[model samples]
Target: MTQKYRSRARNLLHLGSTQANENFNQMVSSKAPKARHYGGSSSLMNRVSATVLQKNEGHSYLAKDLESIPDPIKLQNFNDFVTFDLETTGFGYCDITQIAASVGSSKYQSYVYPRCQISVEATKVTGMSHSIATNKLYLHGKEVQGKCIRTALLDFIDFLKEKDQPILVGHNIASFDVPILSRLLKEFGLHREFVRIVPAYIDTLKVARKVFSKEEVNGCYKQCNLVEVYLNIKYDAHVAVEDVNSLQQLFTVKLKDKCTDEDVYSITCKSCKESYTDVIKNKIVSKVICEKLSKDGIALQHLQLANRRDPNGLRVILREHGVPFKKCEDLARKIQEE
Candidate 1:
C-alpha cells in the first residue's frame, strides 16, 4: 500500500493542474446554486445547458440569444416595404439634392434646388451642382429642371401617401438620412403629413449588423459593400434612384425573412428623438469615440447631465472606457458648446 501511494503521488505531480475543471465547476455552481434545489427539476437541464453555453461562448451568448428571439409583432406582408435613399449636399445642416423611393414596380425620384451651394466634394461624388447664374440644376454637366425644396418635399409626401403607412427602409437612415429628413420636414412645416404617411422606418444598416456575423460581412457594412457582397453585382451608386434599387434587391434576397415589425422604429417614438449615435452623426466626436460610448451604455442625455454636473469627471469616465485623451477632450468641449 505504501509503494502504491508513492507511485500515485508521482503520477499526480507529472499530470497537469485542475484549474480548467475548477472553473467549469465554478460556472455550474453559479448557474445551479446549492441554495436552491434544481437537481430534480427540468430546469436543471436548462441550467446545465446555459452553463455550457457560457463556458464555451462567454457572456456574448446572452446578447446573441436576445437578438435571435422573435418579436411578438410581425408584418402582415413583405410587399409593403418601401426602400428609399437620399443624396445630400453635405453632412450637417445640409440640403437634400435628390430623393428616391421604390415599392415593388412603383418608383419616385426628384431633384431639389438647394438654398445653399453644393460642396465641391458632394458635387464630385453625386455629380449634382447648381448654377446660380443660370438658376438651374445640372447633373453630370447636363442641365436638369428641378423643384424648390418646399415643393419637392410636398411632392415626396404625396408619393408616400399612395401607400398605406408604408414601412420605410434605408441604409444608415437612422443615423444619417432620418435626422436630415426630420429636420427638413420640420423646417418645411410638413412633419405631420410625412409622419402620418410613414408610420415606421427601418435602418437596414442596423439590420445587417444584427443579421450577419461580423466575419460574414467582412467587418464592413457600407451600402455599396453590402450590395456587392449580397447581390453579387455592382450598380451605379451615389445616385439616389440607383441606390434605392440596389438596397431593395439586397433586402429582398437577404433580409426579407429575417426582419420583423418590431425591428421597425416608430417615426413618432419619443425615445427615438435623440440617440448617442447622434454625436457621431452630428460630428460632435469621432465615430470611434461614439461607438465606445454606446458600447459602455452611455446616452447623450447622460453625457449632457454629466457634463453639466462634473465636466472633468465625464472626461475621466470616457477615458476609462477606452476613449483617447485628445478625443475625450474634444468631445467634452463639443458637448459643452452644445
Candidate 2:
C-alpha cells in the first residue's frame, strides 16, 4: 500500500469498525430518513479514511496486492477521475438502487434501499429484485451493502470530498445519473452537500455516441448503453462495479491512441457546452410560453377554470399555443432523443 492509503487505513482502524457499523445500522433501519450528521467533519473524515481499507481476506475483485499496484493515475491517460455507475429503480422519478464508484485503487459498492418498490421494467433491466436490494450483503471483496440512499450518498459525498473532487465518468451520467441523484438529494435535504462536492462530469455515453454513432451491430445502429458499446467484451452487465470496470477499460481502449490529452479535453468541453446550451434554449422556450399565456385572455380563462387542479389541461393549452409543455430538463432530454 502507498503511504497515503496506509495512513488512511491506520486512521480508519483508530475509529474502530464495531461502533461505526452499529451506528450505521441503526441509521438505516429507522423509518424516517434523517440528515446524517456524521458527527461533523472529523467523524466524516474517519469514514472516508476507512473507505480505503479492504478486508484482509482474499477476494477475487480486489487488488491481489495493494503494494504491488502501480499508481492509478500514472497508469491511466487521464488520472483525476472516478468512474461511477448507478442502478436505479426505473426511468424517471426513480431512486438509485445501487451505487458503485472507483477512485484510484479504492472501489466502493453498495445496494441502496430506494424506499420505494422497484418496478418490473427496472427489475428486468437491472435484475435488482426488491428482496436483493433490501437485504444486507457484501460485494466481491467483503464490501458491505444494504445502505439506504441517504447513507450511500453521504458516504459517496465524503469519498468525493476526500478525493478533491475528481471528474465523474460514466455512461449517460450527465443526462440521467446526475439529474436523478440531484433530485434524490433534494428530496433527502442533501442537495446542498452534493452540490458542494460536485465535479465536472464526463458522460461516456455522449462520447461513444459521437464517436461511434454510425457503428452498426448486425447492420443496425447500436445504442449508447455501456454493454452495447463493448458488446464483445466479457463482463457482467447491470452490476454497478462490473459496469464501471468495463467502462474504464472501454474508455482506455477506444480513446487512448485516438486523441491527445488536449484533444480529449477540448472535446469534453465542447460536449458540455452543447449540453448546457440546449438547456438554455429550453429555458427560453419555457419563458416564451409563460409570457404568451399571460397575454392570451381566452387561454388564461381556460387555464383558470381547471388551473391548479388540472395540469394536463394547462399542457393542452400550451400545446395549442405551439409551445411544448415540458420542463427545461425534460425538453433537453427530448431534444437529445431526436
The residue-by-residue lDDT of candidate 2 on 134-220, one tens digit each, is 243333334343766778888888877777546677776756777787666654556545544552466665566556645443333
Q: After superposition, how far is residue 4 of candidate 1 from its true place, in Å?
A: 99
Residue 250 error, candidate 2, Å: 1.2
Cα RMSD (angstroms) for every candidate in the order listed: 27.5, 17.9
After best superposition, candidate 2 residue 335: deviation in angstroms? 25
Reference-based lDDT, each prediction: 0.75, 0.54
User: Candidate 1 residues 180-271, lDDT tens each?
Assistant: 88777765556656865775677898889899888977999988989888778898789999999999999989987888654666554332
Top candidate on lDDT is: 1
Assess the local accuracy of residue 123 in candidate 2 as a C-alpha lDDT between 0 and 100: 72
Worst 10 residues of 1 by lDDT: 65-74
